[model samples]
Target: MKPSKNIVLIDSSRPIDRDHLLPLGRLRDLPEQIKRAHTVVVTKCPPEMDIADMFLWEQRLKMPAGIEVQFTTLKYADPLPVFPQEADKRYIYSKFAILLTSIANPRHLRYHLLSFYKISSDLEFRDHHNFSNRDAGKIKRWALKHNKALIITTEKDAQRLSALTQLPDEVKSRMFYLPVEAVLLRSR
Candidate 1:
């Protein structure tokens, strides 16, 4: 398919952290990009993401007067598992072990949800589960077994997956990656 001249792709995965607002980076350039595009496609936003403030910020930053922000749901490729316990160390330990050791684990789901929602820092073990491609492969297997859709992961994963020589056809067929871009929109 031909790339759309009218669309600009934005990575909603990156949190609105302080460093992002520093000086030079995608965050600083967002307002200008929004002003230029007639439509904006936000990839990786959680299902319930609210764009009210994002739009207001665009307007506040002097984005084009009538530009519109459109959201798209990019399926999370490796959705973390929705486990059923918080205090059961044995359960938590088992779940964590599955996430770390099993090829079909879904523990990342918790982390993703937590991060996406900007959950309180008071939450414990925030830095745990350091994800890697090995874990991602396990996720792919899990998705296949569950007949689930492939996830939309970072470009890094897309690159790695593409280069994988032993990936199964089932997993390969489910791979649908959304690339990020910023472009000018023609007057419409």
Candidate 2:
């Protein structure tokens, strides 16, 4: 299907470090490139995000002076079994859990999980990482120490978890992921 509009999202949870979009004080793209966009959606904003911060991004991205800068957030959803066969059982939210993620930024995912479960530990990997049996061992060790621990991952990471067949059956049995998606915040 042809696209009607183009949208670029910037995570709002973290402050814009460098002058430009790219980090490390680098100039990756021309100001005009970012300004010509039809819409810019800032993602991963915390619940306390304010208008002052929204306007700060508008000025920083070099967007048009009066253009509206809409915001979006990482809205977390229901927890699902990592292994398909275990679908019938409801996730035990009360259990102490370990946060596992290979996304670019995992802070928000960790924050979201803490609201529902006790966070025992975290295993963060590079963005788009392919989990290995070695990595699974670390999670297993952590869960082993923490009684009734659930190893929870993000929805995107859940897709990758299916490919991680080498993980121990023990870990697979207790693992699950909470779905998360970008949701636009109330307009200014």
Candidate 3:
């Protein structure tokens, strides 16, 4: 049960950060793993990433001379209703937002939203955090205080939020999630 081709993926943001001092077993063996990969993908890159940075990533990751490296950035889609039947589309036009995220890296989404909304409050949780009743109550309280603000979450977080049946109708009506997709950056 082996694939014909092996691809290795790395987060473009990792090598530049010096804080993660712990040596992961896989990180220690990345060079050897890259040697076996047919392609190497650098993910979570900035959309404006240029060829020069891509080349630098190769050097930083110790990519072999001939291995192909491709860069990808997460592209966010327009806000979609978390609960379509209860959602009010006008909330999308709000000038303020209450950001709710439970993912590893939310900076990308926050950056994108900054262009459209003045974030009133940003609530972050560890990656894949389950929404508890207390959490929903906290969010509901925030949404109530910022009456005109939209409640925005990631598509991943929306799935967990949607499962909470106890969320108030007012909260459900203003909730939306941004869908994100990874797009390859091409050198022009």
Model 2, residue 124: distance off in Å is 1.2
Best by the TM-score measure: 3
The residue pairs in collision within model 2 are none
lDDT of 2: 0.72
Residue-wise lDDT of candidate 2 within 1-188, one digit each (tens)?
96777665555654344346457533356546656557777777876777887777776777775445688777777788888774424445555888888987788877777787888887788999988877767777876887477878888888878777567676677788887777777554
Task: List the candidates ranked by TM-score, beginning with the highest.
Answer: 3, 2, 1
Give the count of colliding residue pairs in each prediction: 7, 0, 0
Off by over 4 Å in 3: 1-3, 16-33
Clashing pairs in 1: 76-151, 77-151, 77-152, 80-108, 80-109, 81-106, 103-138
Candidate lDDT scores, in order, read 0.41, 0.72, 0.84
User: After aligning candidate 1 to the native by TM-score, how far in Å is the CA of 88 from where it should be?
Assistant: 25
What does candidate 3's lDDT look like per residue over 1-188, in tens digits? 98998877777666523324336422645345567877888888988887788777777767666777788999999999999989999999999999999988888899999999999999898888999988888888888899999999999999999998879998999999999999989521
TM per model? 0.35, 0.78, 0.87
Work out how many backbone clashes candidate 3 has.
0
